[model samples]
Target: MSGAAIALEGVARTFPGGAQAVRPCALVVPQGEILGLLGPSGCGKTTLLRLIAGLERPDPGGRVLFDGRDVTRLPVEARHVGMVFQSYALFPNMTVAGNVGYGLRVRGVRRAEIAARVEEVLALCDASALASRRVDQLSGGQRQRVALARAVAVRPRVLLLDEPLSALDAALRERLRDELATLLRRFAITAVFVTHDQAEALAIADRVAVMRAGRIVQADTPRALYAAPADAWVARFVGGAADLGGVVSDGSLLLPGGRLPAPGPHAPRARFLVRPGGLDLADRSEATLVGAVTRATFLGDRLRVEIDGAAEGALVVDAAPDAAAAPGARVGLRLRPGGLIVVPEAEEAP
Candidate 1:
């Protein structure tokens, strides 16, 4: 089945006692593309999904559309959208095949057709061999595969995944994450996946929408978001330990030790962001900082150095493990032009 187009216009949700769970949020998911809603806990990613599924009503004027047709008033069953929750949510007594076939049977599909469709999805998920096994007997990854197969067995126009990988072990989660991405693309299904994991969203989403306090702060390709965050909050959230602090003045970085040409455009009074990988130990007269290595850790191909004398926080630089400077040795640090992200200063930068 071809993918459906999804649009949310001014969708908002307000809980009782004056809690605005979701602001007026708008987004469009094109046919055959994956859009990820990424944020920390209590950011309303699940609430937004429930809104689109018709399980929760939008505040007064909000609307949800699928394929350019208003579906705000339609019930969940009428929308033909498939959902896979964090829990596999399979019936306890059902075998793998039975769980996968339940949805088809609900729609009144013929008995023979339900069997054929179940077999088809089982093969797609590489779980055909486990068709007769009970859900209780399946491993975590196997259960996830069965859940996904059940969602797609009815040829849904749109798919929604709510933290489906959060329950698995790290290795299984990674494997299933890749598998899910491939399956979505192969079926050409429009999908919205909600996750609190930065790596998971960056790895699987075609475009990621970073949410904060009930609103979308930024939406862009993963590389772009990491390389160029719109503000300090986004930079800190997406960049993790890579967030660097510096002041900008007259097209230069006024670092603690010295000055260097600012990497990007910035307000006269603005803070700068530099990724750890963007800073290197370079020999230059204009290098902004001179710090003594207080600690160093070998990280496979790279070394993480903790330096003192430049700023209050550690200056983490990536270098060849063998090239790491000796502890207590002084090193000059330089910021690469492409490494900096200039954010306008606000009491609280958006």
Candidate 2:
């Protein structure tokens, strides 16, 4: 299926009773790519999707575009966008085939054409055997597939998904997340998905737009964003960050374990960011700081160890499972030069 380019220009929406949602926002989703709108609850992800879908309109100058054509004032029905809700809104009375054919039927398609489309969708979902089954008989994952098949049956210009996988269990969600990612690529559809699941967004999306408090904090590829977040919020939001506070003096970072070279652009006394994997045990003879391993968690192939390094605080470090010291073992930290992420010093107490 062909995809459409989607763009949002200074979109803003305010609901009744003074609930301000989706502050003036501008984003462009390229053709044939999935862009995830990800954030915590009430962060305006859904509001942004609604603005693009024409379900809710932004005030006068807030423009929406499809393939560079202004469609800000177009009604929802006229926009020809496909939307899949979190609930998988299939009618209980309708069979799988019937549910898949609903959109085409609404467009006044002939019975023969509707039959052909339903079969095509059933083949697409690999649910041809369940075509006659009622929605009540299908499992959670099956229902979600049906919902996706229904959304794409009519060949929409753009597909909007609102937490489509939240309803499934952990195992199924993970499996179907991969399936959905493959399906999106195979179908070549332009999609904007709103999700609170960071892993889901990071895994499936071609690009992720991280949202915070009605504003887009950052938008970038998964690898670049995770490796180098634009700010502290993006860093912490993406994963649990272990902060090691230190001061820069005499052209080196003053850490618990002697002075070390600083990384990146920053002022003195900046917070250096390091993922657990960025550290290793420094040779004892060269080590200047000492700490005991307080805890160790074995995660498959690696061990996450929490060490109280120096007076600053306990730091979590990742080590090979076979290489980890026992709990309460005295250990020293070795910060790699490129592993440090430097941020400016916080404002002085006023």
Candidate 3:
């Protein structure tokens, strides 16, 4: 089955006690596009995903449409959407093949057809060898593949996954992030996933929607979102290491620490974000910002240098692995051409 574009028009969810878990918002997911709902805890990303899956209903006047056809009132089963929960939720006693075919069986598919579909999905997920093995006998990675196979075995119109990789250890999760992205593209199915990890969201999804306090603050491609964040919080949350704010005059930000050649619209006062790799340690005579190195750690390929008295608190910068950086050493830093990002003033800036 082909993918369907999804639309949420003024969709919001309010719990019984009048707590608005999700504020009214409109978002569109293009056909076959993988959209990531990204935010911190209690940002309503999970609730929004539930509304799209038909697992939760929206408040009155909200609408959920698949390819412009309304499906707001339909339950999950009728909506023909597949879900993979954070737990993997596989039946411990069931074999891989059995688990993958469970959805087909629920829909009264014939035994022969169910077996054929299960085999196809298991191969797609690279778990064909585990077909006869019980889910409980599989490793964490194996379990995840089986869960994904089960969800896609029936070829649902849309696939919803809630933290599908959160169960794995750090190394395993990093290894599987790319695999999941490849699998989604191969499936070519409309999919929406919930994730709080920014790196995962950027690497896996075609676009990311950043949520805050039950509202969708911004939605854009990973590159656009990083290069041009809508505000200070988004900048800090994405990739920025420090926030520096002061009056900008003649293309320079006059901070207490020093002057930074920040190019942005002239404002009486402005704030700039220094992304971690955006600052380079330079000679004292040519440096724009100066500080004392508080801590330095060699991060395999490069050196992570944390400096104090730069802007406010510690500002981290990426230096060459062999660079001379040690605690208590004074250092001068120069901003790269695209190093600083100018953002609108907000209380979130520190």
TM-score winner between candidates 1 and 2: 1
Model 3 local distance difference test score: 0.89
Ranking by TM-score: 3, 1, 2
Across 1-350, the per-residue lDDT of candidate 1 in tens digits comes to: 47689999999999987888889999988888898999999988889888877878889899999999999999988888888888878888899999999889899999999999999999998889989998899999898889889888988889888898998999888888888888877767888889999988998999999998888888998998887677788887886634346566677666676665774555666667666677788663556678788888888989888777665466677766787488998888887657666665555523
lDDT of each residue in 1-350, candidate 3, tens digit only: 37789999999999999999999999999999999999998899999999999999999999999999999999988998888889999997788899999889999999999999898899999989999998779999999999999999989999999998899999999999999999998898999999999999999999999999898888999999989898888888888547875567787887666888866664444567888888999987888778899999999999999988878667899999988988999889998878888777766511
Q: Which sections of candidate 3 miss by over 4 Å?
A: 267-269, 346-350
**Count: clashes, candidate 2:** 0
Error of 1 at 241 (Å): 5.8
List residue ranges in candidate 2 displaced over 4 A: 257-260, 263-271, 286-290, 310-313, 336-338, 343-350
Error in Å for residue 110 of model 3: 1.7
lDDT of 2 by residue, 1-350 (tens): 47799988988888877676888889999898899999989988999998999999896679999999999989999999888889998999899999999999999999999999889877887778888999999999999889988988999999999998999999899999999998778768999999999999998999999998888878998887787776666766786556666776655667674555663356434566666766776666776556788888888788888887542667777887776577888877776555666544443211
Ranking of models by lDDT: 3, 1, 2
The window of 10 residues in a row where model 2 has the poorest summed lDDT is: 341-350
Q: Kindly give the stretch of ten consecutive residues in candidate 1 with the minimal lDDT sum.
A: 239-248
Model 1 gets an lDDT of: 0.83
TM-score of each: 0.91, 0.90, 0.95
Q: What is the lDDT of candidate 2?
A: 0.82
